[model samples]
Target: MLKWILRRTTGKCELERICSSYPAGAERTRAVEYSLSKSKLAALKILLVSDGLNASDAANNIITLKGVDITRNEGFRPALLQCLRHISGYQKLVSEVTRLQKEKYSTAIDDHEQQLLKLWSLLKPARSRKTSKTKRVGELGFQGNDPATDFRGMGLLGLQNLVFFAENYNRSARKVLSESFHPKFGYSFAVVGINLTSLILELLCKEQLKSHFYNSVSGEPSLYHFHRVYCHVFCEFHDFWFAEEPESVMEFSRILELYKVHLLSRLTTPGMRLHSEFLAD
Candidate 1:
């Protein structure tokens, strides 16, 4: 709430960056590559001086602090080459591992259509929701919150089960429900609405998140992701949760609250707000 208001007040496109209320973990897959690059620059500087060549100004600036004559130090070349070689090998291994994991995930999802159907059936309708043959509301989104407790509570474990039966939610499932299942289950079907999608996508865009709120003794899933997927699935119902209390600008916090938003925290030109407004409709 605070972040949303700060973006609007400060006029930033951070609508995609600030709504994260969960933990997405360290996404630093490029850390090793960057470390390698820095190492290579330092090593090349040493090699240059060993052959009686001067370090480039840019390289010299870094070497000034390290106080190491990499070129003069013949012993380090083997270590540097070995490190470079190791980084290269690790990159290949990471790529292969990622590829295999993606394949396994695709296969698992591809094989579970009926299970998804069965679990989705668990979304019984509320009285106000329209009864159509679609999993969507014409305008309103999912309107129920006395969540269907027939399954395990709303957590990754719950979605894991759903995902277990989820055979490619990416395609025909949406199409088929967009076509047929809703007619049969529209009376029962509930789905997400735009506000929730925007919020979830916004959460995914955050550069950082404070996620201790998601910790549980069981280590089930991040609290933010849990609420996020819930919003994704049920935000389409009539009076869907987010719609029940639309976002409002906040300038102050209550006694028991600690909300903060920083629209200009890292801004180089505060006047960009006006420039952005000039170009935006």
Candidate 2:
């Protein structure tokens, strides 16, 4: 019989001391875990050195990493499915914000909002190379508003109807991002958006299957115990799905692949905001 003398922890981590026991042949499993953890740390170091991931970027990514893993848990099929949808919805919000911020498009959200309004434009293309007095044109419809051809139509009925839902997620990520601005802003965003988003996420998570369960209880749709991680990721996922993401959102997916199966997973790390890291620095 053999016993490991110490519990595992990162060498630089503040944690210290433990009793660790494993099956006789569990060395291989232990090795894989150690290797994976080391790799994550190594990636962080490499990114820090080469990517110039300053204190703020490092802090943001860490907070963001917590949000991204929600959809990766395959075990919690229902929650995972809902998160996937939220992620897609949120990505749309990302594009909107990014488009509004570019040097070429720097303006209020509504300014470019008007430019993109052309869902379909009337055209005058003809087979005749020679042009004379011409009769008026052909196909015409709004650009993004046209449900027939426009990818993002308009309203809930439009191609981009889901953007409305995604907007909630963007608001969620903004709270996380607000750590860069002010603690009050971050807290404010979190409280306001989560209160609303929790409802939205709860609905999205339960609408199909859970809704049936609710029908029997209150004679209306209701979720009994709310999901915390589901809401966190729904916010993070949907924000990434619709908002102006850089590399942070993509990074979270990579981390979630590390965990094993379960009913649904809670966030491995408690979420953080810029306020905490900013204070740390």
- Candidate 2, backbone clash total: 20
Local accuracy of candidate 2 as per-residue lDDT tens digits, 81-175: 22222222233323332332222321134433333232111011223322111221012212222222222212212212222222333344333
**Index of the highest-TM-score prediction:** 1
TM-score for all models, in order of appearance: 0.24, 0.19
Model 2 residue 164 CA deviation in Å: 7.6
- The CA lDDT at 10 in model 1 is 51
All models: lDDT? Answer: 0.29, 0.27
Candidate 1 residue-wise lDDT, 1-281, digit = tens: 76458656754322112212212211111222233244535653343223222224423443354454555543333333322332333333333323332332111243333333343443321223322223342222223332222121222233332332223232322332343233322322223222222233233224121121122111222333433343323323222222323232121122001211222231223122111111111
- Model 1 spans > 4 angstroms off: 1-112, 124-189, 193-198, 208-281
Highest lDDT: give the candidate number.
1
Off by over 4 Å in 2: 1-173, 179-217, 222-232, 235-250, 256-281
